[model samples]
Target: KLSKRYDCVVMEDLNMKGMSQALNFGKSVADNAWGMFTTFLRYKLEEQGKRLIKIDKWFPSSKTCSCCGQVKAELSLSERTFQCECGFTADRDHNASINIKREGLRLLA
Candidate 1:
């Protein structure tokens, strides 16, 4: 359904193994089959003639403010909310998603 709605989809190239270990997901990480899911999604999107664009893992999407384009030097993972000096406050994940969208669009351009 989502693949048909959007011609292009963007995703960040993440370090899944490290993340799973660091986040202590236990058996859940392996059980979830994220890799398999991604593969399935890729095939499904391809079948629909849609695109899946993967941005670099090193891109600081989480640390960058979506509204002001300010990049913070350090943003700890413990900080769930992102508060920028430019008066932009948003959930960390939400801000990252916005930055990811912008970066993906830039890549397309």
Candidate 2:
């Protein structure tokens, strides 16, 4: 579905294993099979002549406001929503996704 709908997919190159060990959410993180999913998705995208762009893990997507471009100094994982002094607010993950996609496009360009 993704291959047909989009020519490119953007994502963060996260360290899930490190997160699992450090954060002590091994069961939850490992159960997601993110690595397998990523591998398969890459293969499928390649097969369909699509592309998958993975940005660096430390790109500060969540810490940067997607609307006003304000970069926060700190953003906790528990803070499910992102708020900026510029009056920009959005779900943290959603904002991050937008940033990731924009960065990916920039990389391609």
Candidate 3:
């Protein structure tokens, strides 16, 4: 469905093994089947001549201000809101998503 609907798909190349090892919810992370899902998505996209771009896991998607391009040195997991010095504030996830989308487009260009 994704391959047919979209010309390109962008995803983060997460370090699942490292995360599972570091976190207490190892079983939950392993059970989420992210690796399997990405593998299947890759194959399906290739079969349909669609593109799948995986951004680096280390990319500071959540730390950078989406509006001003300023990167913060530290952002704790407990901080659900992303507040930048430039006065741009947004939900952390939403801000990260915007950054990811911009990076994906940059890569495509």
Candidate 4:
């Protein structure tokens, strides 16, 4: 349904194995079946003649200020809000989503 509805799908090219090994929630990550899900999504998109754009995993989507394009040197996961030095503040996930959307659109262009 998603493949037929959307012309393109954007996703982060995450290093799942490395993440699972580095984080404490290895078992939980493995159980999520992210790899399998991405595989299925890719095939489904291909079948519907849609494209999947995967942004670089290393891109600092969470740490960068969505408004000013300022990249922070450090941003802990505990910080739920993104506070930029330029006086722009927003919810961390919302800011990251904006960055992701911008990157995805850039790739499409």
lDDT of each: 0.89, 0.92, 0.92, 0.91
Candidate 1 per-residue C-alpha lDDT over 50-78 given as tens digits, one digit per residue, 9 for 90 to 100: 88888899999999999999899999999
Misplaced by over 4 Å in model 3 are none
In terms of TM-score, which candidate is strongest? Answer: 3
Shift of residue 66 alpha carbon in model 1, Å: 0.5
Model 4 TM: 0.92
TM-score of model 3 vs. true structure: 0.94
**Evaluation by TM-score, superior candidate among 2 and 4:** 2
- Single out the weakest 10-residue window by summed lDDT for candidate 4: 22-31
Candidate 2 residue pairs in backbone clash: none
lDDT of 4 by residue, 19-63 (tens): 888877777777788989889998999988888889899989999
Q: Tens digits of per-residue lDDT for model 3 on 31-108?
A: 898999999998999999888999999999999999999999999989999999999999999999999989999999
Arranged by TM-score with the best first, the candidates are 3, 2, 4, 1
Off by over 4 Å in 2: none
Summed over model 2, clashes come to 0
What CA root-mean-square deviation does each model show from the true structure?
1.3, 1.1, 1.0, 1.2
lDDT of 3 at 83: 100
Report RMSD for candidate 2: 1.1
Off by over 4 Å in 1: none
Sliding window of 10 residues with minimal summed lDDT for model 2:
68-77
